[model samples]
Target: MVNVIIRSNEANAAATALTLAARDHHVCLLSDKVSPGLYQFSYFGEPRNEVLRAVDELKAGAPVIGVVFAEGEDVQAGMQDVLRVASPQLMVIVGGGITGAVEAAEAARRFGLDTSSVLQIGAFLFGGNLSSVRAEKHDVLAGFLGPETPDHLVELALATFPRLSLGNPAAVALSSINALFHVPPMLLNAMSVERAESIRFYVEGFGDSVCRLLLELDADRLRLGAALGLGLVPVQELKARYSGPDAPKGLSLREQVNTLSSQTAALPSSFHHRFLRHELRSSFAPMAALAAAVRVDVPTISSILRLSEILLEEDILDHAARPAQDFLNLMNTHSLSIN
Candidate 1:
């Protein structure tokens, strides 16, 4: 059995830990404040129960499934702790945009971990709450952070996530759809969000104009991907793919998104929500920086960032500078052409 260390006890992380545990892997979930012990976790939609054990409870000598998915510092710290405690067979950074992936890479480098053992996924494969997670079954794009990741590691990752597809790390990172999907809606619906109006984020917030702008931003992302010689899928197509068998087809991108996202969330009550913070800071800003580095003009992305900064009262691009540079450095190391 593989001993897996997952960072954060958040919905996604908890659900992932439970999924792995069900697969007979001894899963240990890490949270900064949560105590170490076995906790009863229930799965909804399909009503089931699973036990999530603490990190301290992992048995010695078990093969480690070192896949981690968490926010910025949390992921780095979790990687450090896992490296210190276990002889991880593989280190997977599930999803945190390019920034989070770079942070994981840096952590692995600091520990002198083999670059081949480090993997970066473009996004999470599951979606749901802390109590339960439904596998979205999206085509998960991933790649090694360095020059070469082993075939066995690839097999293990695919075994863990059957939908996972190996690809360029930069392409995988750039495939993130959050910035293209979330930012425009949030920006357009700012006042409603601030007012705490109970509105369906995808349905009500996404008007024709907002959808048009979203497409423009997506075009920029695609161009950036092309500049790096990676063919990133459009956000609409990605969303449709994630929607599974019953996914609507031939609809406008907006219609497809609104229709497929039957589980649309309510607009956040404040601009302080991670919808803005994560998508803008971690996703969009870094993409903008990459665009600048490659001489790709992403005017729409830039405008969104500027507007988000004005709304949030801080510099989004500046906040993302370090991660953007780290991403560029990683791409350069891979010898990818910028021209």
Candidate 2:
């Protein structure tokens, strides 16, 4: 069994730790907020017991799975903490936004860590919250931020996640399904967010208008990807791929999204919610920056970014521009072959 160190918080992190523990891996769950000790948590309503330990409790060289969902400074802080503690043989970044992963890789460099050992999953592998989790049967994209190589780290990652497949990190980042799926619904339902109404995020929120906007944004995303010489799977295709065998056949984007019965359907109470703030700042803003660099016009995406900035009363696009440029520079320096 792998001696795993899981840096966790929020539903995805908790659920990931629980899933690993259930699989008989020696999972040492580390959290800044959760108190250190043995804890019993449920997985899909079944009682499962696992220990939630502190980072310092980690062995000198265990593999760490960083289930960081936070963006910006939080991503840097969390990743630095993990590197400081275990100096892990392999560090897997799961569920963080595209820019969050870039921030994490930079943090590793600051610590003199071998960035080639860092692997990032394009999305979270599960579909539920901390109270319970249901494993997603879809394949996930993962790749090193640094130069590609065959190593024990890759083997360990593959063993841990059987559905994982290696791909170009740039493609993986640009292929972020969250930017396509989460942003439009949140933008269209601004009044609901302002009112703090508790509507189902997908089932009730993904109306015809939202789907139309999502399609337009997704088309621009594809264009951006093509400009960068990357083949991006359309958002509808991605949803179908992730939804696995139960996905309805030949459904439109709206029909497919609205029919996702297993989705955790709670709308964010305010604009500050990660669905809005994080997606715009960490996901779409960076995409917009990259699109601009390549002289691609992503009008729908541009519109959403402007609307989000107006709603949030901040300039997210400008904030993301420098970092996005830096990310492209890093990819070039490492010979990651973006084009």
Candidate 3:
């Protein structure tokens, strides 16, 4: 049996890991704060612990691999503990942003593990109650650096998620679409979001004007991808592919919303969300830095960063600067996979 250990922060990431477990694969889910067994409180704070108990009870034949990390525990470091328990023949999956991926890969190398043993992967992990994985084909990216690559691990990942393997570390890092999804909606619909009404951010909320802004940011993303020799697809195209043509099709980002999304109007949510904290930092910061490096102007991304500065109430770009420098150091040091 190909044992798999998924180190994740968001419960949805752990929940996604359980899909493999349901298929009779040995899966271990490590996370911070939240218990792995799933005890969710309702919107009105009503109890739903019975489902959790039932799940645990039935998990005897298919035991639920639930692990709750200590306060302030690092997800990647948790892998070391799992390594001692289950020497997974498949791989240990590290899910995070570009900087996180680099650090995880570096940590694995420090642990004396090879490429065949681990594959670092992540995407737009929208956190809190909003977290979800698309049933449609979405763009998730993967990266590894070594002389001898593991072919089977990549295959396993493809079998698991709708992922595209970007052979270059830089390519994989640059391909994150979280900022594109999060920043635009948060900014454009700030008033509506602040009102605390349900806004179908992707489906109904992303009107023409918002999409235009996203497209502007996307132009720079594509440019950055081109500079690094990576063929990156825009969020609009990714959504179109995921939703299928039968849904709806439009010429531009605004137009595509009518056709590309399955949701007409979504449940109400708040402006106080992870979009600014996680998506902006992970997705936009790196691109803005790279655009400067390549001499490519990215006004939209820069503008979003400034707005994010207001929302986050801190100088956030400074946080990503060190990682960008560290990434530059890693570029020359590690091995690149050709596949």
Off by over 4 Å in 1: 32-44, 71-73, 260-264
**lDDT for each of the candidates?**
0.76, 0.74, 0.54
Residue ranges of candidate 3 with Cα displaced over 4 Å: 9-11, 31-81, 89-95, 122-139, 155-166, 241-252, 255-272, 333-339
- lDDT per residue for candidate 1 within 22-79, as digits (tens), equals 6677887776645545545544366665566666678787667776764433677778
TM-score between candidate 3 and the true structure: 0.72
What's the best-to-worst order under lDDT?
1, 2, 3
> What TM-scores do the predictions have?
0.90, 0.90, 0.72
Native-vs-model 1 lDDT? 0.76
What pairs collide in candidate 1?
A: none
lDDT of each residue in 1-339, candidate 3, tens digit only: 234455546555444444444445555554454344543432223332211222223333332232212112353566576565544444434334556555555666676767444555445322223123233333455565443456665565555543444355566566555556667878877777767777676676778787788788889888766765557777666555444446454376666565433344452354346655566666678667766766778888888889878866788688777666656555545542211
Cα lDDT, model 1, residue 32? 62
Instruction: Give Cα distance to truth, residue 237, candidate 2, Å.
Output: 1.7
Q: Which ten residues in a row have the lowest lDDT in candidate 2?
A: 64-73
